[model samples]
Target chain A: MSNLKKDSLFAGSVKDAAAGGLVALALFGMMIGMQADVATGLGGQLGINYRWGAVAIAVVIVFAGRLLLNLFVWKSDKPVTRTVGSLLPKASSFSGLGRFATPVFLVLAVVLPFLLTYFLGTRGSRQYLDLAILVTTYVMLGWGLNIVVGLAGLLDLGYVAFYAVGAYSYALLAQYFGFSFWVCLPLAGILAAFWGIILGFPVLRLRGDYLAIVTLAFGEIIRVVLLNWYDFTGGPDGLSNIPRPSFFGLDFERGEGNFADFFGLEYNSIHRIIFLYYVILAMALVTNLVTMRLRKLPIGRAWEALREDEIACRSLGINTTNTKLTAFALGAMFGGFAGSFFATRQGFISPESFTFMESAVILAIVVLGGLGSQIGVVIAAVVMIGGFEFFRGLEEYRMLVFGLLMVVIMVWRPRGLISVRTPSISLSGKAKGISADLVQEGHG
Target chain B: MSNWDNNPVLAIEHLTMRFGGLVAVGDLSFNVGRGDITALIGPNGAGKTTVFNCATGFYKPTEGRIVMNRANGEHYLLERMPDFQISAKAKVARTFQNIRLFGGMTLLENLMVAQHNPLMLASNFTIGGVFGLSGFKSAERKAVDKARYWLDKTGLLDRADGPAADLPYGDQRRLEIARAMCSGPELLCLDEPAAGLNPKESAELNTLLNAIRDEHATSILLIEHDMSVVMEISDHVVVLDYGEKISDGTPEQVKNDPKVIAAYLGVPDDEVDDVEEEVGL
Candidate 1:
């Protein structure tokens, strides 16, 4: 310790910098050393400009940065570094402040648009409202997928297939039968659930990785079928001009009997936006309410039991086959509801909207939130959707930043940001939170 | 004695399980007497687990049927039933050789899950429960009370709120037994319940098993390698060797049987008589 004050921090960093400089040189040589330019315009002669000076400077900077990092961080036992981990709540239970946290967040969510409206005016708040709506959509999707992936421990890579089914069901029903959004909503959920059962039947005996592969294949099949079945699905062009959901048949636009006219207020575009946001919020809350209630019910307990050990569940007299199917169906039904909402919100229908990437993002939210944790999903959804909005300006580097954030989260909390499985019931007349280590992440 | 010749709780009639030309349990027949602890003991790979699997509906025997008779006069063909139905309808609950407690769930939740069938009915498949129906709530309270009873019995009432994974090894073994009891079974099957227990823990297990049999009126069928546990608690013992029953009698009678002693001592086929004679048989 006495000798370190003399040369360890300074001399040790300098010694390591030579190797760091060599690494930086290898990395930045092609990145900063060479540049290609078109001499004139579109078809002009291509020229290669080589400037070794920039590369040398980049190497120097990297070396300098490495040296500074070592001196400040690596060399010191207690380094001065900042982390956002402290800002994140433990979320172990709704023990103390957590009970109020949900209601407080709900109240805030309910008042957010109005708050922005009062401050920035209606038109200015539209962007923020749209972002909130997107966040709510993911929250709804996350809760839906949580029932399958989180509760039942079924790795469903084809969740978007159900979402697409719901969207297409609503679109097709509205187009062909002239059904209203109200009529098609339940129909969409039912159709999606039906497809879920169809998928469930074949994969009854499969679990873990095998279940995931089959589901991935099923998702691709749905997309490819939609791509090829031009007459039925409109192929690559997709169906557009999908009908928007009114305020219970009271149109938001100007007419003989419109929402604004009925309310005696001047027609504002933000009204529909606000209405859609509330609709999504209400739907998300319903998903949460149902999931919360189900947790105490036998069906939900069976799902958790099945997740922990299927053989044990069977031995304990849980009908695992039926339990797994119900998980698939119920999860798909909610996805269907959100998909129909997506259709109405965009006033468009497209197979592209329900890609594997969408499924991955939704699954990633459930996982990153901590499986089986309801509040965790909400936090993950907001951080994912809202954070992406914040990172949109990064453009080319946005994906790099996103990947870095995921890696950081995984490193800090491998289970999740909020990885606590609170017991649905407690013997002490109070809910005790099960710590993350005790909670199974599930094999799937 | 409540033997199968009079009133058997479970009867295995020539049960045979073949896995691709290799017979795991070859034409095994046994009777688990009503309200009696029947021990099925064997050396390693003697198909004790295979028989348990067949009886518990994990495996379908190539031949023979298993009949289970409940005290309420309900008789079931255990072989024809599904895995869950064996426990749910036939009233047969079993613990695995490996402790299979729901690690992520609280001990109470694990026990609660065992009472799923009855609670599922009372909840009306969750439609009534979601609306907070009084009927469902009362049923749930009753279920919780039952779970509490088992947890208290296992001496884990103080730690019921904790996840089952947090339980120590000896506690987990007792928890598995507690979980099985939560199902309200007329017959309980335990595979290697004393496999990894200390002497004190093993003695405690003996007490619990005996209490379950005496007080609860539940018959027990166990596969054990622990002779002390078997001899102390078993009312009847069935000895198996190479997928075949070598001896079957009361523990005292079975212990003195030369064939069972030969099987346990691993005497050669030709030296069975010589070994018996040397032991002063």
Candidate 2:
């Protein structure tokens, strides 16, 4: 059966390669043709254009070379044997590599700053630090929401409400009580978790669209409260000059006996940026580890069972209400952590920052990455966030391009980028095998 | 007969299920004796399916007292119990007439899901399941072993990892039975088990039912249209006609009854000769 499956997969890959090669060749041809036409039009207008037609010819030659490669490899029956043999080692290697992913990631996290400093010096290190902070923050949010959307299959449109609650909680607590960032972070998480439970209670009976609508309303209500409760939140003006994280008595701001003077290092903003980056990274790793652990737990299995079939889950005597609430609370708690981190990093808190669009983007990251896939979510965040940053120069066209890319991806891979082929772990520690029945019938 | 007064596996007292204006099961009173293969044989829409639903807690009867006696000596008012609780507490497992297996799940998973209640109990209401305790692991192993046992029993062990939907029509029906059996129910309610099966499959089903009755000691309440399956496996048969019980006796007795024949025809006047001709009496 394994050999048969391997054979079939090899055949599929060959077909995919041939199809991809043909599409690439066609695209190359079109690019060349369009470029030549543009050059001729430029020559007509300016009448001083040099012969740049060689570029188009060169592109065509490259396309032909790719076509020949496809014909030589993809068209042969021997390709199946070669593909199967080559893929077997890679598949085995992947299984072996899976065990070391966590350790490898941990090492990279510790080593990344030094690597950046060594290669790009202080100026470039600051930019890398900023990127790391953004990625880690989003990664934390994604892992948190994974509990709600991926595990419990609850569509939460108001997840950012919890984030907002955390941000505001830290901002309010720190300002009023002179609470440090570390002290306020857990308080923020607790507050968000409380709100999550409250939100979960009302939407317990609602599923799918109704749950989404109610959650969306909940988020909007939180935002509205912040807007109207001017006595506390400062209304539309928002909280400003929120106290940043300090190492003991040393602050990030440039002054006598500040962080730089305390540490005997030059006063660069990279100090704070690097600190925030590591903070968020640690938080993200914690979220990921906790979620991964939860997935192996009974509640995790119950969540998956519920997602697959609610009736079956209930019949199993699983208390779905509690299960759902736990998911919401846990996810919301992580979101709160990220929010607190954001507040501390930016030294500001505002309702405008935690808008519906922020929630949509995070949710998109989850979906685009693939539901219930941690690695997929991280990859999705990198692509989406980096893509958005890259297209920042396009201004008005950025959204248009982003929207088009999403539509194209959805069309090609409706299941998301890294669709979960099988469950992560079974309650029964049996050898995992792809059920032919499931393969034929598709997912529930 | 077999000391039903001690405690019937399933007892329906004054069961009347009304679908708006129409009564589907009207004051139907019956007792399914312990370890008996009782067939609820009737023409189409004779409330056999409705009775099955009511017994399985799928529908709340307009008026009824459905007392389900568990193997552990606990009695449950099934009508009052929620669908999940009925399966979990009452231990009254059932298969749908249309074979409602979780098509997307593997055959093994389907069977394992049936043992969900027991596994939950072993895990102390899923707390151990969450923590992956030794108890939970043992329970899970037991559940998997039970699933495998049932799959093997149903001649589906080889196809255990195959999705239930991908199974052939006959195999799918057998898989459904295997799933229900995995629940370890004292009272197994099979609704039209032979509906879409061929003669050979139907015959195999009879053997399977008999084995379940004898070996597992499970009292079965079967709603079947196939005369062969009804006549072969049913120790006792109850005939219904338009929400009313026409006859209730042994399979031979119900088969030869004039009232049962008339009920089948839907006309009282055509009973005499038709009954004689059908039963060759």
Using lDDT as the measure, the top candidate is 1
Report DockQ per prediction, comma-separated.
0.77, 0.23
lDDT of every predicted structure (CA atoms):
0.89, 0.77
Chain A TM-scores of all predicted models: 0.90, 0.74
Strongest candidate by TM-score? 1
**Strongest candidate by DockQ:** 1
Please report how far candidate 1 places residue B64 from its true position, in Å.
Answer: 2.8
Runs in model 1 deviating more than 4 A are A1-17, A20-97, B267-281
Clashes of each: 0, 3
lDDT tens digits, residue span B75-141, model 1: 9998899999999999999999989999989999999999999999999898898888889989989
